[model samples]
Target: MLVYDVATRTVAAANKAAMRLYGYSREEFAGLPITELRPPEDRAPFLEDFDVLVSRDGPASGTRGVRRHIRKDGTRFSVEPTYHMMRYAGRRGCFVVVIDVTEKEHSRELLSRQADVDSLTSLPNRKRFNERLEQAIDDARRNNTGVALVFMDVDHFKDVNDSLGHGVGDRLLQEIASRLSSCVGPSDTVARYGGDEFVMVVLENGANSDSVAGGACQCDRQSEVIAHVMRVFAAPIAIDDTEFHVETSIGVACFPADGDDAETLLRRADLAMFRAKSNGRNGLQRFTPALGKQADERLSLSRRMRVALSNGEFRLEYQPQVDLQTHRVTGVEALLRWHDAEHGSVSPATFIPIAEENGLIAPIGEWVVQQACFQAQAWQESLPGLRMSVNLSPRQLARGDIVCVIQRALARAQLAPQLLEVEITEGALLNAGSAELLEALRAMNVDIAIDDFGTGYSSLSRLRRFRAERLKLDMSFVRGIGVHREDEVIARAILSLGHALGFSVVAEGVETDLQLAFLRRHGCDVVQGYRFARPMPAVDAYTFIHRFNAGSLVPS
Candidate 1:
């Protein structure tokens, strides 16, 4: 406790506690300026505050809140001081009470850190990232500079979690966080947004003479940072005894160009990240106005697709697969078609990706399986040995209940398991739990076909890891047959590899005699394309199947 003359701003008396707190005896503290208790830098502010308090009409008797104070030995600590008007030795003065709050302030700081940082990676969590991003944007505006928000997603990270386990996944994330931290400058902020996504904020200031012109320096700096980040992942990350070749898709959004606010910048950066992934993973994409439009359209389509299946707007069309040698209809690939009341016909290429992204693929996929199985069963008597091929999405397999879904669909339709061929792309095989799912399907006597053979991350090692009965030559290669020598060579190599592995190769998109003849000459087991027929409704497909087998639908 102490008393200081309010008008003179000088200490008049002090209690034992006050003397000990400031490392001063009562004699030494007496008549000293009250501002002496505060640090030198704070002394001027203290006097200004004192003037304000004394200038008020009423008595200044309230808390002064928390502040830093210096002791006689030059040591500093935090204190909360409260004062009240009083009379000391018959002079106008104020009695002050001081409480040390250094530990309290330290504890509060620790709590704040815990809330702002990710426990797994020790990087700033989304909350802190947002705050920092906003500050960066404000700074950029004031300094006539630019800021870049870089959004990144680990490519096929889910597969690692599913195949290796979550422990490995966590370790991988930690290592990624470390590498990302090492690549960025001290001024930049790196954060783990959530899951496999990470984000960084880079400030572009006039530090470089070239940056004085415009945003070009900002773009250059962002590119340099991104290049560093990419180089860090070039080598395989070793965790435990296993090595993983990790890849990331990056998206960059710039201030004053992509967006002005934190929220807009972050959202646009995420959109650009998706664009990078879609344009084939392990690349970078910059934000553009067109990407925003595409994102809005995707969201709208996703909303409409949610009620599509329930409203009976979805149906399956059968495209016949012809045996190359026999020229007989051996099976049909079930393709989903949507004829929206408002949008007319929506292409699968357009809506399927949106469905996958929004998680509507699960229910829609189940419906496709059920309807296709039912149709196959209905044609059992007419096309006795016909196989029903259905496309299974990677997202469906990721759900971990794909085998159960297919089992239930087959049971409901009473279709033979061997007669059902589930066609999946090479990309699907890269997912976690996919191998187990395929094994379970094989155990159930279902045939597995690797669709889109020459296009994905397919290797002999992966192909040998799982058992599949057929390989569908992707139309991209088939389209280039005779037109591109390279495509033809790849198509033949795929055919040879499939045959050598004891799998029948089915060529898709055989729209012309040249393509068909090339497949037959190359010993393709089956062929399906527009040359025979485009996809048709179940009723029309049934008639077409009969006509096809009767040789009446054969092209002259």
Candidate 2:
């Protein structure tokens, strides 16, 4: 502790602890000015505060607070300073005591920095970003300014990590952080929103705000933000003597128009970012009302999908797969359909993705397996060699319990595993652990068929890794096959490839005689489309089977 005389502005005395801490002896502190103990930047503020406190509170009243003080070695540390007006040496002076609070202050600062900054890139983290967004919104509200939230994500960042290494990825993120900071103004806040995601909150005057009705940034300055980000990342980055080009998808949402709050703006911006990537990478998108409508519907669908099974909204229709050589029905693929009384018939393309995302696919897939197996036994008895093929969601095979589900269904229905072919999309096979799961299914004697082949950018070598028994060609390649040379070439190539792999090929969307003749000429084993038959109810299917077996079936 050190005692100083306020009237003479001199240190009166010092204790042993003060001498050791300040690297000064009691005699050395005998005539030192209080300003000498504080750093230059803090000296003026401390003196002003002390003068104000003494003048307002009178003589014996004390003032206490924390401040930085320089030691004799010129190193600065924080201290809890207190000044009491007291009588000393027969004159009015201040009794000053400063308690070292450096350690406590350092610990608090460390925790605060750790919470706000990303450990890898040293950029602001999501928590700090949220707080900054709230403050920005508050400022915008007061000043009639609008805030712009920009969401950014590195395109194919996973491929970069896989090809190079995590070390390179980390360096790339650091470089990205530097570039992001360079692109923004001092008033703007940049944050690491997620693993490969970065966000920016820009404060701008509403004089040039976006037009909410158009869902666009009509203001040139607002649109310039996207252009600036593109220009910053246009060049290739050199990492470890290697040059690599990276592209980013950016999305923008303006405040007081896109949303009134932070979370809504963030969500809208995220949706716009998805739209940017969907339109092709290395681009930008602004939040539109259509995106919000779709997002709302998706949320509703995701929530409702959980109870759709119990409500009996889900049903199956079977499309016949006719053997081209024999002109006989070899199998039928089970197609899922959903119809709600209030929302009406929802398209499979729309709701299937919702089901897969919400995890409703697993239970729904199990239900389909059981239903198909139960229907397959009776139909097999009627047609003698009919196979049951059910389409499985990509998530269905990801779950480890799939094989057990297949076993239980087959056992309960007494259906032969050979007659049950599980159809999976190439997208599902791209997921990790799917190959092992499919192999496990095959080990149990169930057949595996690749569904919607030629759609996903799947490698032929990777395709060979999975022991698939059949390839159901996607409908896109089959459409206008005889009309368009491009479709004809693609369809022919897929058919030839399937045969070369010793896998049976099925031509889908065969709606006309020309398509049927085209597949027949190509020696395609199966033809599945409208010309054969639309997916019919079980009772109608039984009736159709009776007619087909009797050699009197005609296209309806």
Candidate 3:
């Protein structure tokens, strides 16, 4: 407890609690004015507030509440000090009651920080980051300060977790957080946005009032800040007593330039980050309106894909697979076509990756398998030896119960495993690894082929390890044959390797007589491309085979 002589600006009396709260003896407290307890920065504010409290001629009841006070040791503490209008020692003054809420305030602050922090990194989480970003944007708008939101993702993070244990991965993440913290200003915020991604909100204009007045200054300065922040990963990160080199791809979104709202800015920044990854990692990309437009297009395509698949707008077109020696149709490749209600024909390259990312491929893949199996079985009854091959994406290989699905489809269509072939890319086999799924498919006697080979890493290794029944050279390599000198040698080597490994070789994208003749000369077992025939409807395929058999249509 304490008493203040407002007119004289001196302490009237001090109690034990007041003395302890101020970290001073009663004699020392009595010698100093109550305002002395406030730090220099708060002293003037306290005096102004005290003058307002005294203008009423005495302390108002209940109107007085918590006021900040500084200790003799130059530490600040909050105190709920109430004053009463009373005549103390026959002088016009006020009676004061001081109760320290410093501990309570400290506890509340700790809880607030804990709520906004990530448990793993002890740094602010996305929730807190969002709050700060909104406030920063508001401030930037008002003062014309430069603000940048940087979205960054670690490169090869999956490999880190796969090659090293997750424990080491976690440690690496922590180390990255530390390095990121060291790269920002005191007022800036760096938050772990999810998994290996991080969001950094930087305020570049603090005292530069001119920068605030000029709306363009904020963006210009922010661009430079973003460039520096992105280069933070040029150095290697040492983790677990071993040095490992890694890079970060960053995307920058600026206020009043890219977007006005936090959500839009973050989304644009994320999309730009993906663009950075696509253009080869270890660089920073600024958000462009064109990238946003592409993102919108992708979203539109994805939504339409769901409708296309559900509305039965998809169909299988078969391209005849010819034998090199006999020139007879041995199989037909089942290619997917989409007649989108809104966008017309959507290419597989456009929707396939989107479907895979959104988990829509499993169902789409199953539908393809079932439909192709049914069609192949129908054709087999006529041709008696025609096989149908359908392509499977990596997502389908990773998630689908391929063995069970194929068995059920075969039983439903009454088609044998030998009559249907499943084509998967080298990427799929690399991810599929030496799993039980591959072995189970083999046990069922399903002929598996690696499609679009030589395009992805581990093609030769995967072909050998999976014992692929067939290998289809990608159109890129096949198109290069006879034009590029090296392509011919590589093509010949691939064919020899396939034959030596007891697998049949198929050349794809054969669009000319020269390519076809060259492929046949190289002992290629089969060829399928536009040169033979574009993928056609089931009825057209049957009619074409009939015409060829009748000698009306000659084999090119």
The per-prediction CA RMSD against the true structure, in angstroms, equals 4.4, 4.0, 4.7
Model 3, position 436, has a per-residue lDDT of 66
TM-score of 1: 0.82
Which wins on TM-score, candidate 1 or candidate 2? 2
**Model 3 over residues 26-92: C-alpha lDDT tens digits?**
7787748767877778778888987877778434755456668888898888888776767888887
On residues 1-556, what C-alpha lDDT tens digit does candidate 2 reach at each position? 7777776677888899899889888878999988889999988987887677656556665546778999989999999877778777887677777889999999999999999999988989999999999999998899887898999999989877887888899899999988888766666788999899999987675333332212234344456656667777888889989887879998999998999999999999999999899798878899999999998989987777766788877888888888877777878888888887657889988988778878888888999999999999977766876889998887787787888999999999999999999998878877778889898888888899998898886788878998799998888888868778988898899999999988999888889888888888997898888997889877877777667657799764
Off by over 4 Å in 3: 1-107, 144-146, 203-219, 432-434, 459-461, 549-552
Better of 1 and 2 by lDDT: 1
Instruction: Kindly give the stretch of ten consecutive residues in candidate 2 with the minimal lDDT sum.
Output: 207-216
Q: What does candidate 1's lDDT look like per residue over 1-556, in tens digits?
A: 8898987788888999988889998889978888889999999998898777767776768899999999999999999999887777888888889999999988998899989999999999999999999999999999888999999999999888888899999999999999998876667799999999999998877354333223335547788778788788999999989999999999999998999999999999999998999898999999999999988888878878977877888999999999978889999999999988766789999999889988899999999999999999999997898999999989998999989999999999999999999999999888767888999999999999999988888678889878799999999999998899999999999999999998899999999989988888889999999999889999998999899899888654
Model 2 earns a TM-score of: 0.90
Query: lDDT of each model, Cα atoms only?
Result: 0.90, 0.84, 0.81
- What TM-score does prediction 3 earn? 0.81
